[model samples]
Target: MHLLGRKSKKMAPLFLALVVSLMTFALAVPAIQLNAQKLGEGSTTIQSPAGKGAVNFVLDNNNPDNLIGVTVSFNETLPAGSIIYVKLYNGGTLVTSASKQLTADLSAGSGIEIDFTSAVPISDFDRVAVVVKGPTIQP
Candidate 1:
């Protein structure tokens, strides 16, 4: 009878431990699935029209190295003889600037690509803002 009591105590603790472990796992699986769902898979694209305005691009550690490329797609036709100016700023300081003249009316879905390479390392930047200015379009 003493041996039976000892065995019951040992088994009781083991069963309690197993129950706790299963409860923990059961509670954790839903959280893991929710996090996975939040990290939705895909790329995001933005389209804008031609106008004199500014667009800000936020850069983080995840940005590509050596080259930062931005493609602006126009939603409508721009005015004639207009020009687009692209400027890159890091932490309130101007880093690089470029411009392209509008030869033909910017077609819907057609846009410009602005590339920045000469700026300081992304590690040195806390934030990056791209300002696009033109006749009618503002990014």
Candidate 2:
């Protein structure tokens, strides 16, 4: 019994260190919040004059890589200074985005391809959103 007591005393410092290490690890790890709501799906109503047609998010054919670009066809020509915004989402979390402002008018029924800089791993994101903002009207 005395020998066992002596062994335990020798192990005390090591046991305390292990406990401290575990506590440190637990503190270093980030906690996932269950209550917080993540931004998910978004829906927008398209008016009559301007309509969003077929959209394809695929790998660029000209510069084939792991990255992807968007090919969109609009019903009508988009005006100059119009802005196009593309967003990639993995579940509710936004993965990446790209925005480009039109320098000239886009012709109707022409498939326009918009590229995203630094876009990679085309398979990672599941949701793709595209928004086009027309040039402001002057009174």
Candidate 3:
């Protein structure tokens, strides 16, 4: 099946676009941390920053409103050409996904924030995952 169930055709393009963007980030980079929550709030970091895997997280927005663009921050410096894929899921259905390519090497102890351009704003308790992978080995 496609990214989501066979429903609205209009949304299919948006979903595909997110996946297609993620596909370009298929570069080799080191394992890093991901923080999709706002500052001063509870931790939202993705665990197991060593191997290529998906980390599940919950949006910690207490406000009674759908989360608009989300900024995901990385804890470590990925290589100059690393790919990152962020997916947000509402229950079992995939809400939206985004990908980013690092133009410069991320320094250690540094963080990179990303904005999600989803058709629907993310909500609290929504499940989120981040998969970091690459085309080759890190330098």
Candidate 4:
């Protein structure tokens, strides 16, 4: 047992030196930061012709993140009691959808932002289409 203690004491200094070297490396090294650059034209917009009931806009966000929201607009004041649907699609398959009811106070030619925060996993080169369904857009 005494011989074992002597051996352990001899190894302790080596272990302590290794630990100190690791600690110094950890403290001396600087942290690396990463960030994603959003594209200048990160969104898509489409104008619905008169008498058309829907406006289809395809946004090929060949980007790093899935679409988060959309801003819809009507050439004229949205009809009262209008039911607008915001549909998201990927490669002809429907992913998710959202809806908004037009109020009297909503002005014409203004944008209606819809949030689709819960979207499917989107990768690069993914084709995401946003279809806005509603009455004809007066223009």
Q: What is the per-residue lDDT of model 3 for residues 33-139, given as tens digits with 9 covering 90 to 100?
A: 99785545465665434343323333336642454444445555566667777777778887777777878776655555655563344443377787766435433
Compared with the true structure, the alpha-carbon lDDT of candidate 1 equals 0.57
Work out the TM-score per prediction.
Answer: 0.40, 0.57, 0.45, 0.42
lDDT of 1 by residue, 51-74 (tens): 333343423346444335456555
Show model 3 residue runs off by greater than 4 Å.
1-64, 135-139
What is candidate 4's lDDT per residue for 38-128, written digit by digit as tens? 7555567754432323243333367435555567766655655466677656577777777776665345666666666564445522453
Mind giving the per-residue lDDT tens digits that candidate 2 earns over 1-139? 4655878999989999999999999999998878867544586664543486667766756666566678777889888888878888899999888877778887888767788786568667888888888887564
Which pairs, if any, clash in model 2? none
Better of 2 and 3 by TM-score: 2
Quality of model 4 by C-alpha lDDT: 0.60
Q: What is candidate 2's TM-score against the reference?
A: 0.57
Off by over 4 Å in 4: 1-64, 117-139
Ranking by TM-score: 2, 3, 4, 1
Worst 10 residues of 2 by lDDT: 41-50
The full ranking of all candidates by lDDT, starting with the best, is: 2, 4, 3, 1
Model 3 poorest 10 in a row by lDDT: 50-59
